[model samples]
Target: MATESFLREIGGKSVVEQIVDNVTNAIINGELKPGDKIPTENELCTSMGVGRNSVREAIKILEAYGVLTIKRAEGTFVKQGFDSKMLYPVLYGIILQKDSANQIIELRKVIDVGILQLAIDKLELESLHKAEQAMQKLEQKLAAPAVDINAIFEADTAFHMVLVAITQNALLEGICSYVDQITKKSRLKAIEKFINDKATERFLLMHRDMLRVVKEKDRAKINEVVEKHYQYWEQVTC
Candidate 1:
């Protein structure tokens, strides 16, 4: 009574990507519910009519995306939703250029501001205190004499990551992993070129203002500061 979808017709990486797409859709659409065990590797290979290597590769990719989990002595199981961490590196690798990084940062700004606005209503007192402490540390780092750009960059990352933590969303945290890695790499490259006191001061000042904005929890202000901060990297296209 049902129409059959043929997997054999799909080609190349398309076939592999198709496998991921099909399985992903099944999980997301509830056709393959979380915790539901999927067919065995051999069964999948038989159904897909693809080589065992293809099925294995597809499974690994799915596992990276958090769409499926494979356990020893058991088969693979679908997850309710893909985890952000699983998606981050892939997402980052897919968009690593300067322009794309800028765009991703812009997107993150919007998302983070919205998240922070919502979180303000639910931010734990301890969370606020922790954020405040991070801000203080950032201030001290900025005021100190010239140090390794790596140190400065790490502090900067911690500041934003702490703000993200306030939302208490594991998915958001994971999604940030790739973006953070790329951003840090780009930042180190950019700062390495400008380690002078003047450039360092400018960087420190921007971070100081960013920390102040986050602490205020002012939606509009935070968005503006975040945008400005991310725009800092837009000039590094070379």
Candidate 2:
């Protein structure tokens, strides 16, 4: 495949940025693809009419973003499949934005609803069993004589993770993982509030509702259940 079209000369200021844009565009346009080796540093410099330093910097940035992987002595290649590192750029972007908390809530709702729909369509008995076990563990944690907030948090995370796993879609799971990290603090706050308000059963019941929705394959109730699930989270975060 001819590389000249996609690797055209990148001119003007912010040479490194331009180079990065060029490579990303190629990937988006299918000129480049996952696992495909990118041009050598010298080739990039020559093709983009940029300095070797600029090309090297662009390559390093892409590698850090998980867009490109550098293998020993083999050269840089477009990364194949999902990389947790890829989430960092997006994670930081959202974190740094003003008034991002509410936006994150909305984002979570959208992702959860979509995930629930997918899980319902692809439901399996084993996955349903795991979700049940997760709920049981959560209940046991809540029912302890001295409720452990940390334990509850872990159990809560596990239950939701099992829901995401039910979809059997790796990309959705990865995105959900990203959302989990971003919302970690707010979710803990919400859980703490539920405990302080003596609403542990309510919390458990919300999760039970999720399991019930999944078990019944009730697509109509997904939005309602997800909204209820994030109630305390919205209250505390907002």
Candidate 3:
């Protein structure tokens, strides 16, 4: 693959960044493709008219983000499929933003609504059964004489995870999982508050409402359910 035509000369302040952008653009524009070996560091330098160090740094950054992979014997190639690591950059960027707490809450509401909508359309008997089982586990955890906050939290997370899984979209599941990971601490805090405030039943009901909306295939009730679900989360986060 002669990448000389796709690679362009670089003349900019952020030469390394420009090189990175060039490679990314090439991939996006179909000049480079998944499983296709990229030009060597020296070749990239010659084609892009950049220093070797700059090209090396650009490739390293791309590799770190799961955009490219380097084999010991073979050269660097574009990664072939979805990688959870690919979302780390987005997760970190969102976490670093100013006033991110409120933003995260809003983002979660949107994601939840969207996931529910998708799950409603794609719901299968087997998946729904799995979700019901998750609900049962959550109920038992909440009903325990001496509640384990950690156990409840894990059950709560699993219930929502099953809902997202029902959609059967790997990319969506991956994105939702990472977003959930970002809010893990706040979520645990919110659950603890619920237990301490004697509102564990309310927490369980919120999840039940989610299951109800999905089972009923009630799109109109999604927003209402999602809003109610997040009340505790927003209380703790914001």
Candidate 4:
């Protein structure tokens, strides 16, 4: 069984990525349940024919993403219940890192517009308020003498996620989680390059404008701002 599933021929992916997928798929298929202990490192390497490094690296990634928990003396056990947090590392390792930032920018446009429409349909006043608060957090980060890239990204991401949350669409939120990870990774690099550029300030203002439009529930303007926002990132990131 391990030979069939875990020892499959490696495709384009690295061994660590393949191992992550194999383990994730096993969990998804119900073959490995929550709280179930996975095979030992030696057992996995022997079964999958991967080196110890690959197995160790794959297990490390899974642990970081909350997929598997390691006990000091005992072996790793599958985490109880599904966490949305688990999906992004798997996605980043397997899909997004392999793809270009341009693809992410394009996807952001489509996803954000759909998210805005759903939020508009619901017209939740509280969502607008939360988005405004998130925008303020981003503004504060941007206005600081020194830029903390992670804080800016967290604030920016929180604003978008808040908007998406208003839609009450579980599937959209999950997809956004993957996108969020990809965007944050890219943003970290981009901010390093553009630290002195005044574009950073305008970027903060762009989100502020977006929040203002959401308060007005202006569909046309919301779409317009979202389009420009993602397009700007694609250009700058490159």
| Cα lDDT listed for each candidate | 0.68, 0.87, 0.88, 0.76
Residue 129 in model 2: shift from native, Å? 0.9
Cα RMSD for candidates in order: 4.1, 1.5, 1.4, 6.5
Distance from true position, residue 138, model 4, in Å? 1.0
TM-score-better candidate, 3 vs 4: 3
TM-score comparison, 1 vs 2, better candidate: 2
C-alpha TM-score for every candidate = 0.77, 0.95, 0.94, 0.58
Task: Report the error of model 4 at residue 220, Å.
Answer: 1.9
Candidate 4: lDDT of 59? 94
Best by lDDT: 3
> What residue pairs are clashing in model 1?
none
Scored by TM-score, the top model is: 2
Displacement of residue 207 (Cα, Å) in model 1 is 3.8
Task: State the number of backbone clashes in model 1.
Answer: 0
If ranked by TM-score, best first, what sequence of candidates would result?
Answer: 2, 3, 1, 4
Q: For candidate 3, lDDT tens digit of each residue in 111-188?
A: 899999999999999999999999999999999999788888889889999999999888778887887777888988
User: Per-residue lDDT of 175-206 in model 1, one digit per residue for the tens?
Assistant: 66557786677777666554653576666666
Error of 1 at 149 (Å): 1.6
**Span of 10 residues, lowest total lDDT, candidate 4:** 1-10
Q: Clashes in each model (backbone N, CA, C under 3 Å)?
A: 0, 0, 0, 0
TM match of model 4 to true structure: 0.58
